[model samples]
Target: MRIGLLSFAHVHAEHYQALLRSMPGVELVGFWDDSVHAQSYAERYALKQYLTPQLLLAQALDAVIVCSETSRHREVVELSARAGVHVLCEKPIACTLEDAEAMRDVCAQHGVTFMTAFPMRFDPSCGELRQAVHSGQLGSILGVNGVNHSENPSVHRSWFANPALSGGGAVMDHVVHLTDLLRWCFACEVAEVYAALQWTDGAGENGTALDTAGIVLLTLTNGVQASIDCSWSRPATYPRWGHLKLDVIGTDSLMVIDAFADHLTVYPPDLTRPVQWLGFGVDPNQAMLTAFLDAVQRRQPPPVSWQDGYEATRVVLAAYTSAQQGRPVRLRPARCESTEDPGDGQGS
Candidate 1:
């Protein structure tokens, strides 16, 4: 499959380039980016760079990866769909629900595949947790808790702080991963959200509207209560700012995934490692890109569909709305069943 890159503004673009190059059945036709810096970066990677979307689309590629700024996602998707090209868009899909829905509709109308880049779902450890939960190793799930914290970006990449550009700070940028994970793990939708937001000294100094600290309480459709603690300011020396810890309480046992420790610890009155470490030792970007290529070649749906992307965006958007209104925000009921295994199947 011939693939074209829509933009290179996102920090994750390098991951995509490396993965696309390594995939067996795919070719990196070329790339397009509006910013001169982005174009220069693409060139440094030896990618054929173009100045406009029209030129990129003219290559007649089979798929396009939209890794542009969040605000430009809808436009990129629309262009790709209109050109009869499949799309793999970066999250949080678009800046608003309307734009996300619009992209979905257009893709459907054009008969083009639409997938969201939610690589966490493909984690090997995540796969094991899903199986453990599904096989009744853990009984009915009770609650979930996640933490994603990182050092604030320097002023040089201040777009993350701008609401107009990045959507709405840390919640917009970080919460979707956990939200989507929870949906897949429990096979349920978020029913409501209550949240509190704060901006730290760094956020103020950066002159961006993004928050540095926040917490969100969620009520899932299956009666699982989940909470997310997300922050953007951490000591620079911290090993990982994006540390994630998940505790899934079931009637029979508890499953914990310590992403920072790179291990999945299971507790059944006696904590013991499972027969398999769910955390596969593979690069997530490579696994996800390979999956995308497989889907395209087989003419099958992507593991993380456009609908999945849209639902996750809705959940995150609801959290932002809840924080802004100082009241609980109710989510629309989910239209489809959630996947049990959020695995990007690469053995470590």
Candidate 2:
């Protein structure tokens, strides 16, 4: 299948490009990006460059991965949908609920599949735990506590700290991953949200004000309580970009997930930068892409539907609202419109 990349602004775009090129039976037709760095990246990767997204769409591509900044997702997805191209959008679907709805509506109207790029769902550890929960191994779930802590993203991309560009700070970047995980494992929606936010280490603002650390507490529809630490408080010297862990409390047994637990840690002889951790596990991104490709090729709906993306975004937005209001915010149960094979919502 022929596939095009919509943007190269997100750091993951480079990795996704490599995956697309390496995957069998898939063609990375080309990519489009208006950023000044686009030419250098395209040249270094020997990639075809499209001056405008329209030209890339004119290639009659089968699907496009939209990895633009958080705020640019709606525009790119709408364009791809209009061109009859399925979309696999990066998470935190949009900066706002309204934008997320618009993207969902447009894709549905155009009759193209829309999948959220939520790689955690494909993580072997997360998938196995979710399966155990669904198969009644966990008996009755009591509560879930998850941590999605990461190094300050501004160290790599300054846009991540800008609210206008990224929606919020660490909360915006990390909340959706765990929220989607909880929803997938429990098969329920967030019924209410409460959050507490803070800015520490003198990490100042980026264009718009942003919180550097936060914790969100949520109550799911099935009476299960969940808490997420969506903080960017990891030190710069940390080995990996970030790590996710979910602790599931249940009546029968407790299950824990270390999403990137397959890693070897090393202490270097050099004192200056001594610690290094190497990951040696199946690439969850590859698994997610494969699922999306299968859906596109088989003319079946994607595993992660637009409604799933919208609901995840909604929960995150509500967290922000609760933080700002200094109180709990109630969320109405979301209505799912598609009968897609959810398959545990690996992509989001």
Candidate 3:
């Protein structure tokens, strides 16, 4: 499979770049990045850097990973679809519902595969948890509590806090993962959302304070209530980058999963930043890429579809709305069936 990366803006681009290079029978056809980091990436990867997306897409590529800024997702997806190339877009699909829907629609109209970048779906632990929940080992799921917290992403990429670029802050960045997981495991969509937000001391590009922390309460269509606690509260001195954990409560039993549990804590000689965590385990990103490649090779739809991303985005937006209105906000019926997994495996 011949594939190229649309941009190097997202942090995950580095992992995907390396994974693509290591995969058998796959060609990582360089990348197109509009940032200053593009030159360094071109040098490190030993791949030619295209000056613009048009120059890169003209390479007769089979697929592309859209890792551009959240707001530019629609533009890149539209371009790739028109060029007859399949897409694997980064999460929070877009800054708004209109843009996200447009990306999905364009891919469908062009008859190209469109997959959402939700790597957690491929995490072995998450997979096991999903199996246990779906199998009845959990009897009847009562409720769930999920936490996905991280250091301020803006510290790494300033765009993360910019509402124009990222749509919102912590809620926009972290809410989708758990929302998608809830939908994936429970086979339902969020029916209502009630949320509270905490903002950062500083403002973004336009004096608009971004939510640095959020607590979202969700009611699923299948009669399940779930709570997600997401924040950019981790300090830089922490041993690990962040965490993803979920506690599933069922009538028969409770299942808890800590995705980054397999790791070692190292105390470095440098006192400035003496301690850090070294995660040691299978790379979920690699598994996700493999699944994507397998689907493309066999002409099968990807396991994570555009609808999954779209639905997850809806939940995040509803949380913001709920917070602003100071009341629970009800969402529209999901396009996916309530009894089935949210992702229909239809790449298009």
Give candidate 2's total backbone clashes.
2
TM-score of every candidate: 0.87, 0.94, 0.94
On a 0 to 100 scale, what is the lDDT of residue 205 in model 3? 52
Clashing pairs in 3: none
Residue-by-residue lDDT tens digits, candidate 3, 41-142? 899988889999988999989999989889999999999999999899999999898998788778878888888899888887888887898789989889
TM-score-superior candidate, 1 or 2: 2
Q: Which residues of candidate 2, in runs, are more than 4 Å off?
A: 200-208, 266-274, 346-348
lDDT of each: 0.77, 0.87, 0.86
Candidates ranked by lDDT: 2, 3, 1
**Residue range 1-348, candidate 1, lDDT tens digits:** 899988877778876888788877778988898885875776689988887898899897999989888988998899999999988899899889899889888888888888789887777677788788778898877777788777654333556666677787778877888888888877778899998998554464346445777898999888889999987766654444446668888889988886546645434455352232333366667777878777777777778877778888887788878888999999878665322122333312
* Model 1 residue 251 lDDT score: 86
Tens-digit lDDT string for candidate 2 (69-93) = 8899989998999999999999888
Candidate 1 to truth, TM: 0.87
Candidate 2 weakest ten by summed lDDT: 200-209
